[model samples]
Target: METLFWLEDSIVGMTVSSTQWGYPIVLSLHAIGMGTLVGVALMLTIRVLGFAPAIPVTSMAPYWRVALGGFFLNLLSGSALFCGNASELFFNWAFRIKIVLVLVGLALTWWLVQICVKRSDQISPAHRILAALAMVTWLSAIIFGRLIGYWS
Candidate 1:
């Protein structure tokens, strides 16, 4: 494997020399996106869990939209950050683990969305169970993402 570290020196140079504060700006958005992604995801899951019947299931669609928005925000920011620290990330085992978790979480989230749409007419219990699982997957992904930085 190439290790994808071919540009480490250049990436490090750019990352460390951001007079325009691009890194901080991207990081800030990434953080905000993460908060929205995890927060809204959990809230919707709880709604599906029946915390608020006032919230029509269709309302959750907006949250799903926000979730997608978060996904793009994080995708861009995370990719740039990753490119900027390829060497460090490549060596960080915790980061590797976090990446795997995130992949699984995203796949599960997509599946959850599909199921929710198809079973819109299904009763609450089954919906609640799947939503609960989605919540767990998202929560675990976020926790592991944090652990990557802390542990590495």
Candidate 2:
């Protein structure tokens, strides 16, 4: 408790929490990061699932760059947000769930990337299943992220 309060009182935390536009600006970046992360993820997953047969799966590979950019952006912005409300967020169930989901989702995405890097012409059942799971995990993270605001 004392630690959280201390963290919340830190310079970065105070700026995010007390400044008129600081929180909103960080939040907007977070939202854009989420959109970039999930949007690129869905594009790759759907392509793997054969949504657009004309576009080769290898072509979709480059989009992972955008996803990674979004992930790092979110990491920075989310940390700032967490600092601003450390005690409340740390104790929030929804925040906990969101963190877990995001971790799992990122792990699954890494696995999917490994599979893609192999560049197999044939899409295995395992590859399809992994892609599907990644999509679901990311979407669930988004849902729980929103729930954190409402439930916390």
- Each model's lDDT comes to 0.70, 0.87
Provide the global lDDT of candidate 1 against the true structure: 0.70
User: Could you tell me how far off, in angstroms, the CA of residue 101 lies in candidate 1 after the best superposition?
Assistant: 2.3
Question: Candidate 2: what lDDT?
Answer: 0.87
Segments in model 1 whose C-alpha atoms lie over 4 Å from true places: 1-3, 10-13, 16-20, 117-121
> Cα deviation of 110 in candidate 2 (Å)?
1.5
* Model 1: worst 10 consecutive residues (lDDT sum): 10-19
Would you list the clashing residue pairs of candidate 1? Answer: none
- Candidate 2 runs further than 4 Å off: none
Task: Say which candidate scores most in TM-score.
Answer: 2
TM-score of 1: 0.79
* TM-score of each model, paired residue for residue: 0.79, 0.94
The numbered model that scores best in lDDT is 2
